[model samples]
Target: MKPLNLAQFHLLIIAILLPVFSMARPGLAQIPKEASQIIDDVVVTAEKRKQMLKEVPVSITVIDDLEIQDRNVRDVKDIFNLVPNLSVSSQNQNVTYVGCRGVSPSMINRRNPFVMYVDGVPFSKISGYSADFTNVESVELLRGPQGTLYGKNAMGGVMNITTKAPSNDLEGRVSLDISEYETYLFNANVSGPIKKNTLFFGLWASEYQTRGYMENDHPDQDYYDDRNILNVRGRLRWVPSEQLEINLLSGKEIRQGGDGPMIGDSQIRFHEYKNPDDYVDADSFDNALHARFHAKKFDIVSTTTYRNATEDYDVDYSYGSSSVSHGILDYENTTFSHELRLQSPDDRDGIAWIAGGYFEYDQDKDNEMSMQYLPTAMMNFNRKTDWPCTTTGKTAAVFAQTSIPFFNAFKFTIGARYEIVNKEMNYHRTTTNLDTNTVVSSAAYTIEDDWDSFTPKASLDYRISDNIMTYVSVSQGYLAGGFNNTIDDPDATTYDPQTSTSYEWGAKTSWLNNRLSCNLSIFYMDIKDMQVTEYPSAYVMVASNAGKAHSYGGELEVKFRPVTGLILSTGLGLVQGEYDEYMGYGGEAYAGNKLKNTPEYSINAAIQYRHPSGIYTGLDVQGYGKTYFNESNQDNSVRDPYAVVNLKLGLELSHWDFYVYAKNLFDEEYYTSIFTSSIRNSYMVGSPRTIGANIVFRF
Candidate 1:
């Protein structure tokens, strides 16, 4: 593959930044002489404490509810380019992967580099983190190792999602949307107080359906890629007295769709799943209980959660019409978690601190089959496998951070988390071989394993002035090891845990009298015992500890409101990631290859204007550099650089909103995924141009 061209890259950067400069000139000239609008300071809970975003000594991004609506961000993947140095991709609906600063998930079942939390309860299970947003309040993306506050599986970073809480006053909203590709969506929400200052409740629900994007010409194939999703959530809050409060949250999700089919290498155009029957159906339920007790000096909080999910799917696998049925999968998973924390009162002036402990229990049961038929020989072989696994984890940690101020200008903060986690897994696998209707052979085996680890963090901050602050930090991250359940090979049964150390320096500042805000950060991470996935056989995947790897990058974010109701925002991410030393299972040398699914650079620019007369318009553009799809770094397995644009026009009035939107306005052609397996090589194309309109009413 050709190396990145410097001249072309420079030109693209100029093109992206030109609009920002050109648009600002006119806004500046028209600024009102008496304009005195002071932008409000953002509040965040990044360090497990309520503090101003600018005061936190971490690289972070905060997307509020207003931004969520303006950007039409309905899911986690929709915010990929909105933030700097972050990416989320999926091989299929059941196997989503997230990355930040070039550090990505190496194996499907291995612990994620980053962790996501909903309403203060962690959702480490891969299946549980991709739910739709129903009543979201805000989303916070904290960069660098978060091991000090959130333990293992947070090597890359953390995503905290907060949902809207119940209010004392009654309120309700209804929304409907229609789009191209035969799509329809509906949303409803209601909240009110059962007893003033004593009890409250909130409920939300949404339904979405689509005829799908791809066209299937094969007479036997009914559908190729379609979508249907449903989400419902409820929340209850109780305040019996001034010193104590209780919260209960529950949700359910149901989804049915056809997984995107791989476009074969020989095919000139896309759109077909050759298998006779190919589809997926899955459902899940979640519940969380949280309580807080207030005291004069400190506060105590506890949370408990339970979740259950099931998934089943049939795949063409062969990517050709040569086979009627290739594979089928059935799986079930459950998780239970508990956490307790003690936090110092926020009113304290001398010092602040928090301490916590956590525990989780999880289980998985699955059965799969692969079939082959030789019509000429009048023979058929079916290999069916069943695996059941159970895991329990216990974590005890004492974390405390103290801040000491000098001359009321500089702050020195030191924090450390001494964590000990013990995880044990009990697994069993059985396989049977069948021909025609008879079983030829059967085998079964059981295996057990355990793992443990520790992580720590530290940082310092200097308030350069009221509008600017600079900080430096260093931290260690950890991820637990687990047995692989995809295959029966002994070597693939277990892999070692992965770990990393990160160093970061950054600055946050507000300029032009708080009308413009800019943040910059540079980070470097060194990882050891890096876990990498390998496909040794056509249908089998395993994880192993490859050699070391390193990632270094810088991110910049800017937001400006040059005039009242006029906003401009831009973000740029530049990353360089490579394997310091590595080799694949078959002795394939790849010591200097780039990481998979990680773009070298990304750019996002957007502008929006809102008139006092309740009218608004916006334009958004995003660009991504080349992304490799495999460890081999082959030219065929890459997504070349591409850009897409979106437009939004809306009208707002008291208790009502109407909007028209279009995505991929330029109709850019790109690939969402590229798969090159021993059985077949295929690609999943991105969604095409789409237009839609939405209406909402409030009472």
Candidate 2:
């Protein structure tokens, strides 16, 4: 990679500061008291308390119901365009990868770097990483390590979503949207009082369909296949007294989609399409319940959840090439979890605290059947079956955090957590004879492992002035160890957990009489026992622990509303990540190598205009620097830097709303994600320009 020269660096800095300079007027703009009150009414639970966003010491971004409705953000992924330091990529519709603060994990088997919480309940299942967010009231993205309060897998950050609750006022809404590229969406929500003083209920449903973007050029074949999703949700809330509230939520979703064509070895020309029989099918269901009680000095919360899913995956390994052929695979998983928390009052002198205990039990099972067809026979060839694995795991943790005011305009926080985890794996593998259509002898293995960890954190925040503050924090995080079902080695069961300690310093300021807000943070992390996966060949994969790694990054975010009806936001991130030691081909030691998918720099900017005449317009742009797709850092297969643009416009009336939007306005041709293998590498391309319109009626 080439380094930026001094002149270029100065030019970039000037460009970033240009907007702020242009908006600097002679007279200071005064904020309306009513508007300030309205903003303060919004509450956030990220700090374990119902506090205003400006009062919290941590860096957080909030998207409320008004923003959600105005932007037509039907899914969680759609919000990425509006936020800074956030990105989402999907392998298919079923698998999604998210990155925050440049700390995402690249290994397929590793758990998500950021923790996800839905309605005060932590989602424990790894598969829940792809859970769709529907009927959501608000979403909060808390940046930095939240190890003390959030426990494990929070090294990067945390995302918390609050769904709409049952309402006593009768209200409902229905919406229909259609767009180019054969995309359709229908959604409705209804809520009202079931009894005078007994109960309230809410119901929501959504159905979406879209055609695939990639083309399959095989003989007698159509373009890329399509995908469909159906979802329904119901919620009930009971408030028998002023001090107690109970909520019950149930949801189910069914998804069916075709896996897009895989990329071929040749890069210059497009590959041929595969037959319809090579498509993948997926279906899943989810259910959950949550309850909370409020008293004079104490509050308690409990949550329980269950989920089940099944998937049938198929791919054309050859990409219509002569060296490879078609392949098929299947998987199924189930999970259950429960947790409880308690919070104490802040009446004590300069002291406020929260403590919680959490427990989760998960059981997962998978079955894989693969077949390799010969080039000549087309439909007949050799077959191999290595499958039937079950995993059972349990995790228990106790954590607490306390905030104390040391002096005027200064506060300190101290927190700690201890966690215990146990996992057991049972596997049974078998081979089937293709000609005889029978299963061969089976091999079985059982293994178990237990782990324990203690993490601690400390933070100090000082209010320099009424409009500016600075904070510093140090925290520890952990990712539990687990057996890899894909490994054939007997010693693969001995893998260890990955742990890290992070240190951060940041400052937040609201300048120009509240017209502009900017935050800057720098962080460094020391990681130990990093777990990584290695693929020596097309069909072989192994899990191993690397010695150590170091990562450092800086992030800057600016939000400016220069004029009465104009808003502008911009963010930038620069990261440097490297592995100190790695085992390369032939077991040779390789050091000082950059990690895959870790880009050096990224930039995002957006502008919005809202006029009194009921017209709203927006423009958003995002750019990512070049990044390596594989650990080996092959030059030819690396992903090139690219930028994308999106535009939106809307009109709001008393009882009706209309919106028109265009994504990928520039029609950029690029890949959002990639999966590489020895036989053939596959790339998931970004969607082409899509123009859509929506109409909604409120009653």
Q: Which number leads on TM-score?
A: 1
- List the candidate 1 regions with Cα displacement exceeding 4 Å: 1-37, 108-110, 266-270, 367-398, 420-431, 437-443, 487-492
116-192: candidate 1 lDDT, tens digit per residue: 88886676655545655657878999987888778777888999988888777666556677787767677767787
Q: What are the Cα lDDT values of the candidates?
A: 0.74, 0.69
Residue-level lDDT of model 2, residues 617-652, one tens digit each, is 888887777766666777655778788898889886
Q: Judged by lDDT against the true structure, how good is candidate 1?
A: 0.74
Instruction: Indicate the TM-score of model 2.
Output: 0.89
Backbone collisions counted per model: 0, 3
Q: How big is the RMSD of model 1? A: 9.3
